[model samples]
Target: MNIPGPEPRSDGGVGAVAAAGGLHTYQLRLHAEYGPVVRFQLPGVETAVSVADPVLLEATAHIDKRPESLFAFLAPLFETGNLQVMPAGEHTPWRRLLLSVLAGRPSHERHFTQFTALATALADRWAERAGRQPVELQKDLTELSLRMICAYALGGDTADPGGIVAAFEEVLTEYLGRLYEVPDGGGREERTRRAEEALAHLRATVDRVVLAHHRGSHPDKSDLIGALVEAGERPARIRDTVMVAMLAAHHTTGVAVSWTLHLLGRHPEVAERVADELDRVLGDRPVPEYADLRRLTYLEMALKESMRLYPPGPYGARETTVALALGDYEIPAGATIFYPFWAVHMNPDYWPEPGTFMPERFTPEEAAKRPRLAYIPFGLGPRSCEGAALAMAEAQLVLAVLLKRFRFRPAPEHEVTPTERFVLWADDIRMTVSPRRTGEEAR
Candidate 1:
């Protein structure tokens, strides 16, 4: 079956989708122009098929292998072998272990206090700067998310939080830069050298934490690293796990919260509703407890709706291990099947006024009317984000705490644009915050 797409250009087919701004924008255009299953060319992959229809997504949901070539940029960060290319048999056990640690309610409950405290601390800082300067939403939130993840994963030995965050950022920036750069570009050796240096710094940092834990100097079996150690994973494997978890946890949650706040900033009515919900749920309390999360129903809906409009991880891909039939098309084995989540979320058939920031779209009754796969901010299938529950909990708690304490309005002259850099990121989500008066607020 011939899938519809642009004719490939001679510059290694990069031009097939280059005209549409970034990859995420290109995908939106591809689906808008050529229906659901649009064939395109991606760097390193032969032929890519993007599926936007949620119903059609159900057909290829079970295939779990990622395109290894596409994820090769991450290979340098792992020492016990690349988790991205692990065979299905081995992948299952690894994924199960991750889910047990990351997806369990007990873990989330155990870490709730720490998460809220970190968020509250940041809010306090922002409170100090309340009329002083615009708060850098992505920068500050990413730091908060990093600190939270480190505390949860590595225990109390995270003495050098700045060092760890810097190292991780350096490593990620180096690799992502290479991944997005034109293939066969100049100065390849220098880029490789810098990436290796960053990788080494990250590995060394993880080694110190692991060694400290094992020696009983910083023993904490309740944390993520502790769980992995208890599960009898090797030191090298544990390092890989920690690095990968940090990589996944760091930006995605921060970006999600940032986007949600940006949306709330633009729509004061929605922000007022969120404040009302927070006011009703946590009447006299400053921060929310885990139980309070369930009561913030409207806040949850607004967060979900924000993600539907701007999913942190905009797209997901799986390479077919067998001949896959999606809709009326048969995708050959080894072909890359792209799940353009942004496109799916914007599909007009499922979401009316797909571009509108209407939080009611995610209310329980309205949500039940849509297909299960229609709003997969985390994704679908077995290899989906194992930290979905944890991420949502963290995001909601942070949003609740921040919104209740302060009012966020977008900076006067700042323009926020969504760009894909391994995740949906806006470099300049400049928003001003003002402390809400105790009685005057939430009215």
Candidate 2:
């Protein structure tokens, strides 16, 4: 059988699969047929695809090590000062500081209680809405994740976040749609314009919060903004970095939530198990504390399974600075190498039933048995998501709280199809949520 790559086959066909919108359906379809490395060269765009273990690791590390030019794609979405746009060397110190305060064990533990409370509050609101017909799961998940990020990252309230979140969502979804034309239509240039406009709105809000905090007149807060202001960085860069954190931190998790809900709706068994776990661990509590998260390992596995089948950041790309040999293709220095986590995660060689939703694949023992790079929902190298821990915590909290209170079934004829952008999202998931009876609720 012929493998998927840049090479033309004996059968007359378009060279490498270049669908209308750079959709790489063929890559996922034939990943097992192909070995580890597959390079596709389009006119003016040379891209390499990798599903092999060694190639994926080396490729990720190579980009993470020297990541200045490779981040240009982000310039249109975030200002140049954004951490995602910062050169590798300059970006390192800030990342270290962030990890120390945010992603590390200490901060994660400290914030767990807060997240649990937030989760319960949100789920309570969802319960209130359970009587109001079917809810759009994608919209609900997006709002929930965005609000949490804003509260945590900006240390703000819900009063005005809705509009800002909506604007950010517009720009994100549009950019994901590949609309990059400048001046005339909505495309890359248009996305940059919208992002800047949205940033201006957010900056005004940030300025108010920052100035108030700086006056030594506000109450102490431990949210993301508080963490940044206390970190003591240059004012301008600090503002830009906060914006970067907001964009980078929330979008992936938002998509993850959407995928999680879609998967649970499709697999009632998984939802039942998660709900059962939540009930067994905690009952009648207003909110679960940080300690409860450990008991939900299966929920973590379920999230991992959802991500494996549908990772938020489906594929990552990096432009090479030097020539590289991949498979039968000789890629030049300027080529853009594509590392598709979606394809890699779904390759049957690595995952027993690549297309199924089986959380067992992520059990500690099973995970240990798999290749490290093979599981990169948070990515593999230094450039891996900084907010991964936070995302996971928030996911567990929301899932546990929501499932404990309500049971959801897929809305009639609701289709869950992935629409790709910087993150992969179920186009629009709709679910019928019913409030569980007192006794029927997670016991």
Candidate 3:
């Protein structure tokens, strides 16, 4: 099949589509301007059409089955045997351990106190810096999220959130930047080296924590590391489990927090409603419990809506290993198919007024009307994010706590746009935070 016209941009801007010879740009522009499914091709690659088509999505369940499509892109950060890279069955044990830690009452109870403490600490910090001071919620939330993960997962906070995060950020930035620049052999090798260096640093940190737990010499340890170490037996599994846990827990939460804040700032009415929801449900409190997450329905809906708009893992790909039938086209073995959620989420056919920041779109009644797979922020079918439930619970708790304490707006004259690499986040968002009190509290 010969696909014609428009290709992925070679210049590689953030949010750029992945195709050859301007195919990504074509798909991005055409999906908005024309219809869902568009034909595109990359130079030196086979002619392949990218589908934001809902009908096509239904026809292809094998999309994420191959690791090479999405996981290969991440190979620089994590090795082939890592949980994210392994075949479905092989990854289950690690997933089970993570699920056991992140799910259930004990984990929730342990995490609730930590989440509240971190949220309170953050709120207090912002309140102290009150007035017209510009506070970067993204940075603050990133720190808070990483800290929570470190404290909860790695025992106490040994991982420097800012420092380690910067190292990983550098790898992602450099690699993604050079990815589209002619695929130079030497450049790719250098990028791979840097990635390995960053991963080695992080892995070493995890190893040290595991070793401390093994030796029974660490104190003040109340996080996931302690929980796993205390479980007894299976030392190697425990180490791999924690490594997977950290990767799963930290980055995704940061992205979710960033997007939640970005959406709240973009939509004042939504933020106000969220605040009201918080007031009605949870009044000023020292900390909130896991059960409290259920009461804040509107806030949860807003998070759902936000995730729908900007799923941190926006684009997922899978390489084909066998001939598959997809709609009218026969997808050959070894072909790569890209699934861009950004395009899928914004498709008007699936979501009316897709670009608008309307939280009500996720209301119970409205939600039941859409296709099951239509709003897959955490992804779909099997292999969906194992921590989806936990992440939502944590996000709701944090959002409630923050909305209750302060009010924020999008930074003036600062355009916040999605910058895509591994996760989608606001490029430059400078927002001022002010303590909110209902007149009587102003004094």
Candidate 4:
């Protein structure tokens, strides 16, 4: 069967996607017009197949190769080649190694204090604002998550946490700003130079931690750098891992929290439920202990539902090594397979009232009735996010603190518009926060 899509244009599929406003909207429109399986041109790739059906996604799950054209921009962030686009054999070991430390209970527990302190510090600063000005959730939260990740990867002895975070911001500014356009005063060259310097500083900080591990001063079960070193990985690879970890953890987790809060502000009734749950679970504690995460069940459900609505990383891609039988169509070997996660999450077949914000959709019983791939905010298969557990822990902890102390209401003057960039973001998420004074006030 011929796959359905718009007629190919002289400019390829760029016009179609751009006219649709971005890939998220484009994929949603594509699937709606042409059904779940649509073959379309993706900017560079002459023809790519996007699979929006969760059941069909199962067959493509084993593919470990990511198409390079879409991921090439991320190459500069790595030293031992791009980890995300590495081959299946190399990626398998690397993913396993990262999961060992990243997904472990000990690792999350080990870093929970630093994480709490960072969240609290941000809350304190917001408290000082006294609701005089609306806070930019994306800006504040991403920086906080960056700090948490840096502290987690480098241990408490990091020389200058502020400088490290600023450096990473520089790197992101360059990479995300399209590398050619200068930010503020600098030319492209100057911006590139600053980003390179920042990347070098990040690598140097990781080297410092690696040296500490070699000296046996940092002995622990949750040491990422130590684990990599113990497994005889190369220095360049260790640096790349930390770099990627910082990049992946900070933005995605930060935006996940922001988008969740964005939704909660719109749906005050749901917000009250989450607040009530937090009140019952924490009992006047401003922050949650690591173990308290499980007890904050409704908060977790709200976060999950938020991610489903505005998934941090909206889509993923892979290169098919062999022919894939996707329902009525056959995807040939070496073709590009685009995973439109945003489309799947809103497929209507799986998610009832897909546009509505209802956190209870994630209650374990409700979720169990759906396909495993039906709700993948972290992605799927071997190349899926290794930091899913850690990201969830970080988002839930941050939300717990902020929601517990403050009640967020959308700034009436500002529109919280969701856009697709590297992550699902808004032009600005301006929300007013006033401290919650009482449990009854929460309800």
Candidate ordering by lDDT (highest first): 4, 1, 2, 3
Off by over 4 Å in 2: 1-4, 7-26, 30-33, 42-44, 47-49, 52-62, 65-73, 76-82, 109-114, 129-132, 156-159, 170-197, 220-223, 322-332, 437-443
lDDT of 3: 0.66
**Candidate topping lDDT:** 4
For residue 41, what is the lDDT in candidate 2? 43
Q: Give the alpha carbon lDDT tens digit for every residue of 1-443 in model 1.
A: 68898888677556745667688999999899999889988878887899999999998888878888878888978988888778789999899988988998899998898889899999999999998899999999988888878777777556677777777777777778777774755877876776677778767767777777677687544467777888888889988998888889899888999999999999999998898888888987999999999999999999988999999999999999889888779899989999999999999999988999999997779989988899988989977998888889999989988998999999998998898888888876999999875665435
Let me know the TM-score candidate 2 reaches against the reference structure: 0.84
Off by over 4 Å in 4: 179-186, 218-222, 439-443
TM-scores of the models, in the given order?
0.94, 0.84, 0.81, 0.96
Best first by TM-score, ranked = 4, 1, 2, 3
Better of 2 and 3 by TM-score: 2
- Model 4 worst lDDT run, 10 consecutive residues: 177-186
What are the runs in model 1 whose C-alpha is more than 4 Å off?
A: 182-198, 212-222, 440-443
Clashes of 3: 9
Model 3 agreement with the true structure over 82-166: per-residue lDDT tens digits: 5565766765664565567666566666667777887888889988877757787777776677666666666655657555665
Candidate 1 achieves a global lDDT of 0.86
How does each model score on lDDT? 0.86, 0.67, 0.66, 0.88
Query: Which has the greatest TM-score?
Result: 4
Model 2 weakest 10-residue run by lDDT: 11-20
Tens-digit lDDT track of model 4 for 248-359: 9879889999999999999999999998898888887789999999999999999989999999999999998888888888889889998998899999999998999888
